[model samples]
Target chain A: MINVENLTKTFGAKRAVDGISFSVERGEVLGFLGPNGAGKSTTMRMITGFLPPSGGRISVGGHDVVDQPIAVKRLIGYLPENAPAYTDMTVNGFLSFSAEIRGLRGDAKKKAVSRAVEMCFLERVLHQSVETLSKGYRHRTCFAQSILHDPDVLILDEPTDGLDPNQKHEVRQLIRRMGEKKAIIFSTHILEEVDAVCSRAIIIDRGRIVANGTPLELRRKSEYAGAITLSVRGVSASAVTQKLSQLSSAKRTSVIAENGSKVTVTVFPKPNMDGELTRAVIDATQVWQVEELRTEEGRMDEVFRSITMPDTAKSPESRVQSPQS
Target chain B: MNSWANIKTIAKRELVAYFASPLAYVFIVIFLLLCGFFTFSVKPNLFDRGQASLSGTFFFWHPWFYMFLVPAVGMRLWAEERRVGTLELLLTMPITAWQAIVGKFLASWLFLGLALALTFPVVWTVNYLGTPDNGVIFASYIGSWLMAGAYLAISCMTSAMTRTQVVSFIISVVVCLFLILAGFQPVVDFISGFAGPKVVDFVTSFSVVTHFEGFQKGVLDSRDVLFFLSVIAFSLFTTGVILRSHRAG
Candidate 1:
């Protein structure tokens, strides 16, 4: 439903979004992950036809964004960064105004507003002025406006930024459910949200796409991926590390924890030998007591920190973002 | 028809937004009180002079009143949207910048018209005092509204330049002041002494004062009407350019 090619936006001397290209199809929820000032909002703005690109092209539902902005805008339902709405208006009035602008009138407008109100749980505050509502209700009111038109494409910038955990979960579920039919793209600082809702996630740093993959695929980029963790008693920490390093399939081993007699150690598998390391470890630790042994599934924050935080990185390999993997 | 619908929807929203706050009531009360005070209590009192027509009494103070009041009414049009971060939402809507601009301008223009209409009791007073020329009073009201429209349009342009309403208000007042000063009676007379008739005509042509004079005198000259309409069109067009440049940045 959406296509962007070499999309770039420059604000005078600074390049906010640099040569970013990605396509979103129906039934896909693309999670945009980046630290602050990484141009997530800028990219979303360009996609929704709010900010014209300095270079490249963007089209929504077969209409060029710059050439046919109205057509593109018609297909998009956008919730901006702060979820701003008319503070002077009541929740119902604001939604009706949004519906009216989207060309929903009379009966159609009423149905749309009610449906959105129900979905966003805005029924309790229907007649209440937005200025009197709390932050969550205000945010929900803006969210309702976006979906009132039932647009085919949804571009939300930080939709769950200021919500409580329950509200965040509800919004994420709504996005996931809506993603089945609409091309949904949302940016957030929460990594778990990417796991919870996104079919695929793209991590960008300093206005560049550092990694792009499914949640599991991206987590595989972590150093602990495919490594085997062993918790055993009757074994010294040094002995576990020393014995695990001698195995042919193990590249190295680190003692994760050293209790009195119990030591938890993890073995790094050699390249292309993750399958053999488990069996190799089992045979090597036959004489020792193996209480718990499992392969690490890796972590999202580890991959995120490794890819985004370059200054503190101890290993150069984690810096590379292999989107195909 | 679809385009008109969009414009109407936007205009209605803007009009409702005005009444949703105390600003509208305050502005109307203040505007009416000022007009009444100046007409009855200030120098050249309406009843003391015993004038039958409202040209010098009721209509004369409109331009000066609108110079400051119109900007205050319009300063929030775009500035508030920008401050609330709704400018992004508004510009990204399916409507064109032209429609949004025209819709918002019409809403505020209609609002100024309403404020002007609230002074109809003044019209009744003039009619009650003596046999007044109702035709001239009607034309003067039309002229007053058009002049207010011109000032309101300039305010829209200034409002688009910044998110601060105070800054928009100050700049709009300054620009509208220049429009009045260009053809101000004293400035025109002073220029006529040093410059030729054509040069003086050229300078006064840009001022609302010169154009509004014809309507105030009960003459609906097409040229005068055209002057006010052109100011509205030109300012609205400039406002569109300013808004487009904002998104382009």
Candidate 2:
């Protein structure tokens, strides 16, 4: 439902979004993962027609964002980063106004507002002034306004930013449910959120997409699969290391730490031998009490850091030669 | 049909917002009190004028009065949206820029008209005492409404330039002051000597007071009506350009 080609947004001397191209299909949820100032919100703004892109083209539901802005905007619902709302307006009043701007009126306007209120769980505070509500409620109110028109595409920037744990869970559930019927591109720094709600993930860093894949696919490519940590008792450290190295699958093994009779070993497996090496370690250390032996599953934080921050030790040419995919 | 719905929605919200706060009441009260005070205390005896026309007292100060009052009303039209960040939401709607602009202008203009209508007591008093020129009174009301629209357009443009209400108000007042002073006798005298009489007359013809004076005399010249309409149209068009640039930038 949305296509962005070579999109770049520049703010004076600074390039906020640089040559990013991605498309989202209907009923697909794409999580935009990035750190602060990573051009996520800028991309969202350009797609929503709130800010013009310095270069490239964006189209929503086949309408060019620049040439056919009114049509494109009609098909998309955008919740800006900060959830800026009219503080003086009541909750129902704001939603009703939004519905009207979307061309709904009379019974249609009323039904749209009522549906938005129910979806965002805003019925309880429908009559309260928005300025008087808590941040979570205010955020929900913004969500209500954006979807009031039932647009085909939803561009939400940090939709669950300030909510408490329970509120976050509720909002995430709502997002997941909405994603089943609409095209969604939600930007967030929360990695676990991507795991929870997004079917596909696009990781952006320093104004560029560094990685794009499913969560399981990303985990498979991570370096965490190469290493294993083991805790053992009743075996001499040198003997355990030697036995571990003797296995054809084991690339290297060394004792990380030793205290009393317990030993912690860090093991690196040879290529194409992750599971084999773990099994060999368990078999070789049968004489010792195996307290813990498992391959480390990399945390999303590590994947984020590794992608964003290239290892300085690697020469520039070598890094450039290495294929990302 | 969609455009009409969009305009109605925006107008309704704007008018409701005006009434929800103390803004509408405050503006009306201050407007009525100031106009009444100037009409009775500041002017020389109304009886001595003997013309039974408000041209000397009530209608004379409208240009200056509106120079400040209209800005006070229009300064928040777009500036508040920027300050609160609702401009993005407004722009993201399906409505076009012209729809939003015209919708807001109409709402604020209607509010100003209501405020002007509250001064009927002044008209009633004048009619009760002497043989007032009903034609002049009618024309004066029309003039005041047109002038209010002109001032409102200028204020809307200024408000679009800045997010701060104070800055919007100050800038609008300054611009409106220039437009009002362009036609005064002293300014015209100063300019006539340097630039030729034709240039002075052209500049004077563009002033708010210059066109409004004809209405005070109960003479609805087509030129005067066209001048006010042109000013309103020009200012609103400029406002549209500025807002479009803002959205693009």
> Which candidate number has the best TM-score?
1
Candidate 1 lDDT over residue span A1-325, tens digit each:
8998998999888999899999999999999998899989999999888889999999999999999999999999999999999898999999999998898888999999999999999989999999999999999999999999999999999999899999999999999999999999999999889899999999988888999999989988877778898999997777777788888888777766778888887787877688899899999999998899999877788888879996674344333322212
TM-score of each: 0.96, 0.93
RMSD of 1: 3.4
Report lDDT (Cα) of residue A136, candidate 2.
94
Candidate 2 lDDT, A152-193, residue by residue in tens: 899999999999999999989988899999999998878899
What would the per-residue lDDT of candidate 2 be over residues B5-115, giving only the tens digit for each residue?
778788889999999899899999999998988888784746667667799788888999998999999999999999899998888888788999989999999999999
Could you tell me the lDDT of residue A161 within candidate 2?
92
CA RMSD per model (angstroms): 3.4, 4.0
In candidate 2, stretches whose alpha carbon ends up further than 4 angstroms from where it belongs are A235-260, A265-273, A311-325
Q: In order, what lDDT does every prediction score?
A: 0.90, 0.86
Alpha-carbon lDDT of model 2: 0.86
Give the best candidate by DockQ: 1
In candidate 1, how many clashes are counted?
A: 0
